[model samples]
Target: MSSAAAAVSAKPANSRSRVLLASLVGTTIEFYDFYVYATAAVLVFPHLFFPTGNETTALLSSFAVFGAAMVARPLGAVFFGHLGDRMGRKTTLVAALLTMGIATFLIGLLPTYAVAGWLAPALLVILRLAQGFALGGEWSGAALVATENAPQGKRALFGTFPQLGAPIGFIIANGLFLIIAALLPSDDPSRPSLAFLDWGWRIPFLFSAVMVIIGLWVRLNLVESNAFEKTVKTGQVRKVPLVTAFQNNFRELVLGTFYMLATYVLFYLMTTFSLSYGRAAIDAAVPGLGYDYTTFVLMMIIGVVFFGIFTLVSGPWADRFGRRKTLIWVTLAIALFGLCWVPMLAEGLVGVMAWLIIGFTLMGLTFGPMGALLPELFPANVRYTGSGISYNVSSILGAALAPFVAVALWSAGDGSPFWVGVYLTAMAVITLIALLLGRETRDIDIEE
Candidate 1:
């Protein structure tokens, strides 16, 4: 090997710290920017953006706008994935973070339905699409950078650094909301009272700037991935990794997308749908726990803490058991766990806590190995393009419509959670089948 090539091959002492810190911090900001919207969609958007005064239509419309981001995610994946593969993962990662940060901050500045009429929602959709697109390439790139930098035989455990972002982001986002909600309490159920919709909620959205700055500082100091570095030195980088992924890696894309559906389904249902249902008016046509808003959020805080912890724990589990094997049992556990939705929800707050604990635990397990499993499925040349696109594309199948569909099912069953549980079960079953079909690549060499 040439001196430059040898330098690229020889891992630096600081590379692991740079990789893990960048992955964890960058993705935490990314998902933090993403999830604050999910929380708003359930708590504030219907009144602020839609303002129809009719419950179901307004809620559905809010979630539809929420789903709009997911629709744009695949396109973002294609664009950013191409950039990451061709140019470099660091460039794409930086760009994606900037796009997300700027867009989220702007959401704090948006005019409400009362102020701008139809233009309000139009602008919201546009900004949300921007967030989804930037996020498309962000996650897979973070995963690739971390796993690629890992020592042999520990990729899954190392990859958890990026995966840790999801729960960390979840906790931070909800925790921020709780803090804001404490400072500005709103008691109206039909509406959030102007105080919250007006300025309180924007605190979290505008706070994206600080998070972005911290993430950027960490990422900018980072070393680039060894895989991409090696690919560059070897002159193997695809001219357009997006096109190359389509031509050769389509199967991995499809299976990987399906394999992650259960994770998405469980997440949205537990977090977003639960928030909406738990605080919904008990007498309404849709089923709900009707817990006080503050109380339900407290339950969520507890759930999210467990979510964050298990995410870290699942990493070593994946490392020891093999990614595929761990995922298979975990996915199956998720499928069976879905059956508990009825009794669990029926048990009220305790049941809700139990339900959330189980779902988030399974979520951490199923998702922890994904950062390793996804990029490992692709060749180094197109790994970023293939893995990023597949991962984001799955959002449409899994998260995009999950809350909307869950509410629709609840309405269908006259406030029953029966059909919603069925939906969760089915998504989990699909993920299990995909796991069974996918090749075990835990021992596969990522460099090739």
Candidate 2:
């Protein structure tokens, strides 16, 4: 090998750490920016963006707008996946993060329905679509970067760093919202409502600007993954990655979609439904639980901590035991946890806490190995497109409709939360079956 080529191939141990940190932190910020919008969609967007004549209509419309991002995600994945595979993962990720940050920052500045009529919602939808598109490209690039750079026999464990970003992002996103909400004066008819509407909400969204800058700085320093470099050296990069993924790895793509269903469903329930339920229940029964909004945020942060820990734990376990087995066990736990949702919801604060802890633990376990498992199932040439499409397609079927479906089910049953649990349970079962049917990819070679 040439001196330059040998130097590139002989990167020091610290290089991997630097690359992992860059990928993890960049993804965390991207997810944070993305999820902040999700939280707002559930809690505030209905009133701010779609203040129609009826409350139900407004809420439904907000969720509809939220779903718009999911719809755009697959498109983003295809476009960016192609770029990553054909161009380079680092280049694609930088572009994706910039797009997401700009969209989120703009969202903070948007005028509300109260101020701008239909134009407010129109602009919000456009921005939401932009957010989804950016996220679509972000996850696959980050995951591939982390996994591809990992040491042999440690791919699953190392991949967890990128996956860890999900929970960390959730923690930061919810924690920021919680802090801002707590600082807002209690909802008083006498006091100016502008405190929250005019400014408080914008704080969380505008915070993305700082995160985006940090992400850009970190991402700019990252080298292209060694695996991608190897692919380039072998002249194996595909000219049409999306088509190649579909043609060669269709089964893995389909299975990946199913594999992600349960986690996605659980995520929406824990973050969106649980928040709304906890807030409403607290408002009605236990005022001393602190502000309903604040309590919900704290609980979410608690869940986020467990989520990160469990994800880290799942990494080595998956590498040892196999991704399929780990996934099946986690899916079963999620299914069982779903069955406890109604009982837990009825038990007040303690019940909610137990529910979140259990749910997030399961989330961590299932989510941790997925980053490596999905990519391992496909060949390197199609890895980016295959994994990207599968992940976002699952997001559409599982997460995109979760809040909306959960709410509809809740309304259909006269306020009973049981139906929401049933929906989650069913999705978990789908994931369980998919994992059972899929081959274990734990030992798959990256360059295969």
Candidate 3:
């Protein structure tokens, strides 16, 4: 090889700190942006964006808009996935972060239903779609970056750093809201102060711009992964990665999508549905746990602390075992946890807290390994497109509808959460079956 070619080939891998930080920070910002919207969808949007005469109708409408974003995620995967495969993970990641940050920042500035009439909701949905679009590309790229650069036998452990972003983001997003709400104290604990409903919620959304800036700085410093560089050197980069992904790896696409089904459902149920269910008034048409919003969020934050801890723990377990085996045991536990939702949720504060802790712990286990597993399903040339499509498509199947379905089931059961638990169990079964049908990805050669 020419001296110049040799130098290019022999370049050292990204420093471990740089790889982990780039992956972790970008997803932290992305999930922070997403969780901010989720918290608002429950606490603020129904009151402002969809001011229907009835509370249930208003909440459902708000959730509908929240779910609408999932529809855009797959399209985002294709668009940004193509770019990641064709250009580089670094540039595509920057674009996704900017897109999500701008959308979230804009959400803070939007007029409410009273001021903008129908235009208010229209703008909200538009921005939500943009958020979904940006996120579609974000997770898969971050996963690829981490796992692709991972030291031998430690890919799953490296993968957990990115997965750590979800819990960290949830904590930060909800923590800001809690602080803001405290500042704008309410006369009645049951209802938000008018000032808070009017303005306090926007701070978290606006604050996302600062995070986006940091994420961009970290990502811009990232050199393309050695694996991706090899694809380029070997002339293996596909001109149309999305098409090639589907044509060549159709089975993996299907399996990966369903493989994530339980994790997505459990996560949204734990975070979004639980927030609404926990905080709704006891005397309302559909009674709930009757805790105030601030109290319930605090409880969730406590549970998410376990979520973060278990996320770190899961990586080593998956590495020691295999991803499929670790996830199988975790997935089974998730199914059993679903069955316990009703009894646990009915037992009042202790029960509810136990449920949250257990559920989020399982969420951590299932989610952490995916940062390695999904990227391992495809070769370097099409890994971005294939994995992005699977992850986002599962978002559509699992997350997009989980809150909506749980709400419907909650109402269907006359405020009982039994049916919602059943729904979770059902999704878990699908995921377990998918896991059983698929091969262990722990040993796969992702660079090929």
Candidate 4:
């Protein structure tokens, strides 16, 4: 075939629906696997894997392991980002999905500390690392898949398809756990049932296999996006995307990593830390709101509904107002929101629910544009590596430490969440500074 004919032939036959579905499903599965582990880190791991005798110590240990995964994420970014930038997004995305699925499924089968001793937590840490690694690559690829195939002026809007996965995944993962706990009711409503602690928690991890299969089916049907195809045809594919990313786009790398800082911290705080805080008995050494496990998860699910809504809503706003400008306003709101945590959570159920709703709403707004903005920061030659590294490294700085730090701050405040709110505001301020230093990415020609 002639060069022109080959170019025409290489145009993806994938419909818009297929592109959106493939991107959305892959991330849904990825985040579902992640949120399952996050929920388990709060609900089960402290009891099963880390028996430190003290409640606070055990929970801290579980969170430490959870945070360890964040350390592996940047490494995953380098490895899989290389594959994606050089090999193509389709195969790399499939590999990432498979990796995360296998790790999550294996987590369900692992023996608890009571059965296997120290080796149990050791193995859990390894598998958690694998999950983090896989996810490091997953988001960038999904974001690329969505934005690259978007029609003119719609990249930001299309990008939200993948961003939507966070709330969707959170709902499914937490909702399933709530259902399982409800079915296996213990005499006390506040704590997890014995059955749930023993086996029900594993169900969510094992269920990942089913979702992975569906994600694989959708992603396997995808063709490379035209933006990436153009790079391939032009012979612009980098031999070492990671190195090239740093060499050519060092500023974007720094900016992108910090840009996501507030989102990471707020999300973990809302889901993991809040679950631990909301459910602890009011008279405990570290007092909490004293809600039951099921009730708190339900509240989080309700809050996540706003997360999903605002995620989609932010997309159109980003497309219309410019990604940077919209995100600047959202980040500022997140900063202000952080200051209100004390008053909000102190008000009882009405106050706590309002706090959750508002926090997650801001999470959606801040997180939505990143699907396009990060990828748009770099040209196609190293976009996968650049964005993946930035996103995951921020996971280490922001998410990996958020819960652990919040727990410490909560203890320091003598059960008050004031210090935790301060920590969040500090992170938000960092994100805001980064945003100010960065350029608007809404109009960037990603194909270049």
Question: What is the lDDT of every predicted structure here?
Answer: 0.86, 0.82, 0.92, 0.92
Per-residue CA lDDT of candidate 1, range 365-424, in tens?
A: 888889899999899889988888778878998899899899899888888888899999
Alpha-carbon RMSD of each model: 2.1, 3.1, 1.9, 1.8
In the predicted model 2, the residue pairs found to clash are none
Task: Give the candidate order by descending lDDT.
Answer: 3, 4, 1, 2
User: What's the TM-score of every candidate structure?
Assistant: 0.96, 0.93, 0.97, 0.98
lDDT per residue, candidate 2, 1-448, as tens digits? 2443354456543388676897799889888987898788867787678878665577778888888899999999999999988877778999999999999999999998889999999999999999999999999898898888788888889878888888989888888876776677656421224577678889888989999999898888777666776777677888899888888788889999999899888887777766655554323321112335665678778987999999999999998998899888888888888788778866867877888888888888988998888888888777888899999999899889998898788767666778788889999999988988899887777976
C-alpha positional error of residue 93 in candidate 1 after TM-score superposition, expressed in Å: 0.6
Residues 1-448, model 4: lDDT tens digits: 1463365356656789999999899999999999999999988898899988899999999999999999999999999999998888989999999999999999999999999999999999999999999999999999999998999999998999999999999999988988888788888865578999898999999999999999999998898888777787787887899888988899999999999999999999998999999998999999988988878888989999999999999999999999999989999999999899998887888999999999999989998999999999999989999999999999999999999999999998889999999899999999999999999988878899
Worst 10 residues of 1 by lDDT: 1-10
Clashing pairs in 4: none
Candidate 3 C-alpha error for residue 76, in Å: 0.9
lDDT of 4 at 65: 94
List the candidate 3 regions with Cα displacement exceeding 4 Å.
1-12
Stretches of candidate 1 above 4 Å error?
A: 1-14, 189-191
lDDT of 3 by residue, 36-61 (tens): 99999988899899888888898999
TM-score of 2: 0.93
